[model samples]
Target: MKTKKLLTLFLLISGLSFYFSQEVVIKDDKVLLDGKQILKAEKINVLQYSFYSMKDDEEILMFRQMDNETPKYMDDDYYVLNFLTEKTKVESTDFTKILNFMNSRKAMEKLIKWLLKERVINNDGELNPERVQTFKEKYDENITDRTFR
Candidate 1:
């Protein structure tokens, strides 16, 4: 029984180490991946929004930034436009349908998984752009553009 417990503990530690291996650091006007510089800081932009605090029911302001060139940040739409543009042309009206699909729980979970694995968002859920380019390159090809109509 002791041996089994030790084995289980070892497995858990190993799994956790592998899961947390990806890291992002922003410093000196650059973004870094695993301590290596990856991209210029200018590529990123921060955005602000207002939300109500669940605990106090008070309105609060928050900031979230994305890569300035990202589709979600461009043109004031919520759809994944960058992924769409790479595959096919999209019209303005398509944003609504795309937003609905992407907002589903399943879709949100998958995207969040990718984001976490790629270190696009840090543990605090703030923007971490060190791995943004890598995330884009790896996932962009997997996206499929569809028309709601």
Candidate 2:
């Protein structure tokens, strides 16, 4: 009886773990968060653009790769600096919105460090204000006159 109880308890814990497991997968150019499609990518010209659809909004967040080269040993180089409407309308905006949103927040610090780690931005000095400013300039330059799919 004790052995049966122990086995039942083990089975119960295993079942619970499986039930609570969350899966993240990128299959067929679609990003699946917990088995739900959140973002989808399409190759356009030399860049691969991914659009994220919000459940409650008609607008979708758009991201694009900086270059055509896919990083084999690193994460994909993309940034969410734009959005689009349901009718495939591109929104005219700049880095101000992203900069303001991330300013003075922990996300800003994390992004700066991540950019440095990914070699997206140079590390002149930790206290240098131009580190982020330089990135803003590059972002604005590349995002100008974007072609939408």
Question: What overall lDDT goes with each candidate model?
Answer: 0.40, 0.41
- Please give, for residues 35-133, the per-residue lDDT of candidate 2 as tens digits: 666445343433234333334423243443343244663233334434343222222234333233423232233333344444433332122234334
Pick by lDDT: which candidate is best? 2
Model 2 CA deviation exceeding 4 Å by range: 41-149
Per-model TM-score on C-alpha atoms = 0.31, 0.30
lDDT over C-alpha atoms for residue 18 of model 2? 80
Worst 10 residues of 2 by lDDT: 86-95
- Residues 2-47 of candidate 1: C-alpha lDDT, one tens digit per residue: 9999999999999999888755544454345566543333212232
Backbone-clash count (model 2): 0
How far off is model 2, as Cα RMSD? 15.8
